[model samples]
Target: MIGKHLFSVEAKHEFVRLPHFGPFLTATAAGQAVDSLLARFDGLSIRMHVLASNQPDGVEAKEQECAYQLECACSEKSPLSVVEPLARAGDLPCAEEALRIANDHGVKACEIGYLKVDEGFLLLHVHMVTADLQKAMTATRWRRRELLGRPEKGEVVIMTTPIPMLANS
Candidate 1:
């Protein structure tokens, strides 16, 4: 389970409608897309969200906060400030695609969640939301493996030292 303390950043989103991806993407394609997109940000990692405030309904017009995990890759590094510019970059196709999808769905706003501490990453409940979440998550996971190297599986393993503390002291 991902500890709640892991999410130290509460990103603010300013959007007007919903955004969606094109046809469902294969894991390889999704990973490549995210890798290409991340280069724009100099390979910094971050979590981003795109939300659509519930539309007006009933006489009182109560506002309901709708949470959506927009189809995008993320990392347990970098800040929203760093990720936002790349997202808003004029020549970025991913950002434009995001806007186009949101326009098509009539989204309300977008939020970009980022990491505030240097901690081992955890995959959130992106699975509960959309297939796109998996696509993006898989892409980021693969990317992480590519850069940091993955642990090899073995029948027997040795723990030569005490477990280190994961949280701040």
Candidate 2:
């Protein structure tokens, strides 16, 4: 099984100018990128979510988008993260998808927050709670069998990633 460690994430902006479309595109994209990265974590589930004030105009569309991203993240089997270059490839749909899923699960409920930005980077946040840390470690191992009905043996990797968005910026 993967190692056991408290995982938490809070993003930071690097201050790079985003495309002319707007900060929504930039911020949302970064959030999605975080969801993708989180998906890599073994058995790492989205415990909660929070909608940004700048989110989409329509509520229905936004819910669909959030659900999708969280689904992707739920499917992961490894701890996820983005290096300097990879972080820039954030996706908007991913954020929307994750949001929906988090909302549906009602596990990691929503809360007000902000992303930390510096230079050109942005941070999205997730607060995960585990009753049993060992259980969480074991959970990652069963993912393959639970979802795919397949079994394998290997060391489950532990994870520690900052939130999708930053906080206290």
Candidate 1: tens digits of C-alpha lDDT, residues 1-169: 2111111112221210112221112334334434543543332343332323232233122111111122221322311111111122222124555456345434322421112223422111111122232333344444344435335311111111111111211
Determine which window of 10 residues in candidate 1 has minimal summed lDDT.
Answer: 154-163
* Per-model CA lDDT versus the true structure: 0.25, 0.33
Tally clashing residue pairs in candidate 1. Answer: 12
Query: Using lDDT as the measure, which candidate wins?
Result: 2
lDDT of 2 by residue, 1-169 (tens): 1112112223322211111111223345445645654544333333222334433456445444544433433343323332111122133324454455445434232321223345443322222323333454455444324435323322222223323432122
TM-score of each predicted structure versus truth = 0.17, 0.22
Best by TM-score: 2
Give the distance in Å from residue 85's predicted Cα in candidate 2 to where it truly belongs: 19
Q: Candidate 1: how large is its RMSD?
A: 21.7
User: For all candidates, what are the clash counts?
Assistant: 12, 53
- Report the poorest 10 consecutive residues by lDDT, candidate 2: 14-23
Query: What residue runs in model 2 are displaced by over 4 Å at the alpha carbon?
Result: 1-89, 92-128, 149-157, 165-169
